[model samples]
Target chain A: SQQGEEDPQALSIQEGENATMNCSYKTSINNLQWYRQNSGRGLVHLILIRSNEREKHSGRLRVTLDTSKKSSSLLITASRAADTASYFCAPLTQGGSEKLVFGKGTKLTVNP
Target chain B: DAGVTQSPTHLIKTRGQQVTLRCSPKSGHDTVSWYQQALGQGPQFIFQYYEEEERQRGNFPDRFSGHQFPNYSSELNVNALLLGDSALYLCASSLFRGGRYEQYFGPGTRLTVT
Candidate 1:
């Protein structure tokens, strides 16, 4: 299935505190992507980490991929109130069909 | 450039009724994909359209179908709706060439069935 299931379905943190979320997938993937959704709105793409790459960063977001464990983690540094949202990870399977498999996401709450 | 766009922000229907949702892909993108997201869950891929054809599909049933127009717009039609069918229907657009996997999502159309 290659579905990326996130751990700790929910998390609460204070403003300026860092929040980390973990995701584990079922199969090998070409790349893993992270997305954030505010409330029930559309998902905003955060970052994409390729299979060969161990880590990638975008602004306050840091993503690390461990293909050996078929898992990935997203770290948000100095999170603000605006960072409160539902985070999702998508694992894109290698070869064959190129559809993304997503799991139930991790809901993050950043208190001001 | 404008990102992906969807029509009918919210919809209400009764069981056994039919509903159709629409989406317009991002500029210069030729592929569109549809997903169904239940409350508190992630989006589930329904199907994908590329070159005006269904290229790949998920585990959804035939009751859920879609079409892509020549202008890169798409429509999702569901027949014989059920209470379980109520969800946020999301449409995403991406370039299908060169194995690009990044997608731009539209503010989903929230559907509620009674």
Candidate 2:
């Protein structure tokens, strides 16, 4: 069974707008990572936030994690048509296992 | 350096037949993991291999077996394929056995079972 679930199964926005996607998990985790997948392609790692961290930023990507609430959010600012893809959140288990349980993911479309 | 790579970009198979998918981890990486993603679902963990051994596995059945070679490359074999088994098979490579390490993924092999 999947441990995490992402909200807003799909989102559509115009280019240059901001896109935000949320994910919630049921178990304790060591870290949470986000990924982006283009159509019919593999995933690309976006960012990872440890349990002790609250927020992180990389270029136009911002991620916030609320361990108390067991949730995390990804914010993509100045979205581009190239940003259209599926986004997934994966949470690592507390046992320090190499496996990462992933959420259903959010399909984002940035129209130019 | 090349990222993770998988072979046979696409495949078609019949029910009850077997299929083998291969993966070469990113340069200098040691661990490899496999995942299955349905059309609209997230990628599910199939198993993980480390030091030429099956370190951990997900809830998949015995029919889904795998092997890790001495070179850290891996192969996923599904015997007696079922229609439901048709999905994108992804191979990911990580540096270590812990969760803090980042994983690099391959383009994946799309399998269509008849």
True-contact fraction per candidate equals 0.61, 0.67
Ten-residue region with minimum lDDT total, candidate 1 chain A: A93-102
Over 4 Å off, model 2: A95-97, B97-100
User: How many angstroms is residue B37 displaced in model 2 relative to the true structure, after the best TM-score fit?
Assistant: 0.6
lDDT of 2 by residue, B1-114 (tens): 999999989999999999999999999889899999999988989999999899889999999999999999999999999999999999999877444467899999999999
Best by lDDT: 1
Between which residue pairs do clashes occur in model 1? none
Residues B2-34 of candidate 1: C-alpha lDDT, one tens digit per residue: 989999999999999999999999999999989
**Best model number under TM-score:** 1
The single-chain TM-score for chain B of candidate 1 is: 0.97
Alpha-carbon interface RMSD for all candidates, in angstroms: 2.2, 2.4
Itemize residue pairs with steric clashes in candidate 2.
none
Model 2's CAPRI class is: medium
- Give the runs in model 1 whose Cα sits over 4 Å from its true position: A95-97
Chain B: TM-scores of all predictions: 0.97, 0.96
What DockQ do you compute for every candidate structure?
A: 0.62, 0.63
